[model samples]
Target: MVPQNPGAAAAGRAAPVHYTHRQILEILSGLMIAMLTTMISTSVVGTALPTIVGDLGGQDQLSWVASASLLTMTASTPLWGKLSDILGRKLMFQSALVIFVLASVGAGLSQNIGQLIAARAFQGLGVGGVSALAQVILGDVVPPRERGRYSGYMGAVFGVATVAGPMLGGFIVDADGLGWRWCFYVCVPLAIISLVVMQKVLKLPKIKRDTRIDIFGAFTITGAATVVMLILTMGGKEFDWSSMWTYLLAAVAVVLVIGAVFAERAAREPILPPRLFRNPTFVLCSIASLAVGVAMFGAMIYLPQYLQIVKGMSPTRSGLMTLPMVAAMFVTSTGSGQVVTRLGRYKWFPVVGLALVASSMYLLSRLHVDSSKLVIGADIAVLGAGLGLTLQIMILAAQNAAAITDLAATTSGVSFFRNLGGAIGTAAFGAILNNRLTHHLTEGLAAAHVRPPAGGGTSLGTPDAVQHLPQPFKGIVLEAFTQSLQTVFLVGVPVALVGFVVVLFLKELPLRSSVSRVDQAPSTSPAPTDAPASTPATAPTPNTTA
Candidate 1:
């Protein structure tokens, strides 16, 4: 017989176990701590990277530092969700915290870029869990109607982390003798505190489950995602776009995905169940997520470059300049969440958000070398407003569409795709920026009657030396910056348009308060062999797997 409380067998005794309001609050606080701490780690590093790369003597590896984290996080996202479903929420949450803390320490102490990237990959595994599982657990503790307020807090935490990360990273990096490694050092203590608080305060019902996990599906999907990411990373950079290497990688990714599809179909408990894709809301939301991820990530990643490269701002100053956008996002997201919670409606946000995003991107495309700082800042603010409206609400939409039991997995699936899109966007757009910049620089050199450098195509955007170019050359470099940034905006326009289209098809569903999952479960009364009885609402249908 399945034990009613799984923790009972471990404790070997009955324990008092009704959760009160105060107890639930205490439990949620642990999750909030973990959420803020993890987001801080992500944003802080992005701001400090310029300093870190200069010290490490490998500017080439800068993208990899970020890419490594995204890759592992994307690949492991569904695994975390599936495992949490099988292993009990509290166990997975605490385990994720411990892994994150240890990984934070390793990241801080790394001596080389390779070590740093490897540590980040490991750290990402925990980050992947924390982000996915937190939302999952939140769905458990709160009903859909009440979840908006909490989701708002999550958006605020995200905004705060993004805004604060750059400032904090800049401070730690610029502080005399503290060095860039301390940026990583800063989060370690916070993580420890989060861990202790979680252990002390968090108490979730343990699911007494005994089921086989879809190990093969996890492996296949991970393989598929990794291969696809590699293709995006290496295309038009390390290999020719039409080269054999490109075709080979593409083929491998395609084959693995086909295998994964079949594997998911057969698995007793799939990591990413193919059936979820058939839900119209889930499908549209996922598509919209891809577009939103591309637009948001590509723009954010490049704006700092525009500040540092063309505007001639220091890393710290650039980070500060980003405050307006991040700040605007924070306010709007929190306010919108509360409004949605109170009004009981949300269909308009995505439509309006994508419109704002598209308009803002179009405005940003108009930026040139001579554009004023005021204009650029204004554009970023508009983009931030769009993002504030889009990101978390799509998650709410996905949650509302899913069955109660699939809440965590469905939410994480949306998150996983969004992040996966971001990784691909960042890598792909970075390559585009590099290629376009090089081409413009070459054309400028040719027009100026200047000889190409002896070794040919030496790096032109070196941070220490870019500002020192002669007057006409500096103008040319800035023009290249303008051109490359314009291309990013051009690419983003179509992405937002696509998002607009997908969101138009989404069906509106009512947001409900928490369901009584335990109360609704089937009764264990023995079947009466001799009398006809009415079927219960909880009785399993013929096709029901559960």
Candidate 2:
């Protein structure tokens, strides 16, 4: 049916527009660099952190350096996305870059652990913006049907950074003159290059409209998340799990979350819009992302401990050992993305992916203290393949399902859940490991009638520290850790299956062919993109499977 007023309809939006493959690649280069800065920050620090804390002289504060960033990064993600809607995406992206660059400098020059931790926290605020905006920007620049092809490159970047960060961190700490400071300093130049390229190549139409900052909503949500994160990080380590402190913090987090809900309802432009929750696709994707985080990060963090402490490998070697997983992730993510783009069907990838995740977690649980490296490698590769298929595809589906007006919120909301899940999984898994290890150690020590070693051998500080324990004690400690890790992997199986169940319910809407959602109201929000900007023409249309 022809439009009653063709000229008026055409005037409502810019002419039908899309980017050439070359144009998309140009924009993606800048995004990929910024993405690397965020991705590698934590993992790179993981290896160098041992050396960093040793030189800085605050062994107790070591965990804070990592957790602080994660805490801030996860909490601040939604705020960044909302700000992009109020302000413009380009300015927000550039602003995050500046913040990150400055924080990196401070982190490198720090003479004390406190300063380093503080800088890392600030780095997280920036990292949060860069991380969320990258996905939001991707949605703005590419349509859902063709998005998979470019997302493949993003998966490759993620795969590379995941392994490279640890390897580079180990190399830096090992090199005579490089030092731990270089670990922070090294990304500075790459970030600066990214900033320059973004300035030159990335362009999105400027939007001018009256928009509120949603200050109250931001505060409540951040407070709620921060309180929960503090409980997770501090519990089972800084204090007793059953202590009054835990109870107090948990109560505070609950109250803050309740407050956040009300604040979001009242605010004109909430950080997380209430309506997004009503979208089935958004809810399902968020749930699935949370599970993905639990499986992916739980494995990433603990597997290293298993390799370094249980199997006696160097940090560099452990990083290298995980390459099989990375290779599998790269192949499946890219391959699956290409298939999704061609067929315009994505439900199968994540469904199959989560099944693999569940299967791999169970396989990992079956690992013995004496499991061969090849067997371990094979199990992780399955995990990599599953993660590759699920991670970004969930975001893509969420984006495709949202209205043009909700694009940024949908992208960031899913991301926030994924990171939140990671925080929860990492902390919960840590607790499980500590508890199970304690039980196993007690049993082993009693069986042999051995006394506890000089420095509380059960906790056994680092992987390096575990290696130095005397003969029988070393063997006992290794066995305890091995058993505890099996429980950790085993626990993840149920979690992955839950995510698989959630993804199965998601509605696969037809992939939109245009850069912007043409069937919605004129998008008032400013988005980062190179595509032509115009008001949408047609009345909002319901999603139909493509």
The numbered model that scores best in lDDT is 2
Report the C-alpha lDDT of model 1 over 1-546, residue by residue, as the tens digit.
111343533343222144555665776777778888887787778777655666665554666777777788888889889888777676787788778778888888998888998888888888888888888877766777777877887888778777787778767777898867887778878878878887777655554433468888988988998888787776777898899999999999989999999988877668877778878888888889888887787776677667767887766777787787887788878888998899878878888888888888888888887888788889988888888888888989898878665677798899888878777777777777767777887888789887554443535534445677766767777787788778878878888889988898889898876533333223343322211245222221111011
Kindly list the per-residue Cα lDDT of model 2 for residues 217-330, writing each as its tens digit. Answer: 888888887777777767877898899999999999888888888988776667888888889999999999999988887887778778877888777777787788889999
Residue 370, candidate 2: alpha-carbon lDDT: 90
- How big is the RMSD of model 1? 5.8
Each candidate: what lDDT?
A: 0.76, 0.81
Segments of candidate 1 deviating more than 4 angstroms: 1-25, 58-60, 452-456, 460-462, 516-546
lDDT score of model 1? Answer: 0.76
Count clashing pairs, candidate 2.
1
For candidate 1, which ten residues in a row score worst on lDDT?
537-546
Error of 2 at 114 (Å): 3.8
Which portions of model 2 miss their true places by more than 4 Å?
Answer: 1-17, 49-63, 110-113, 522-546
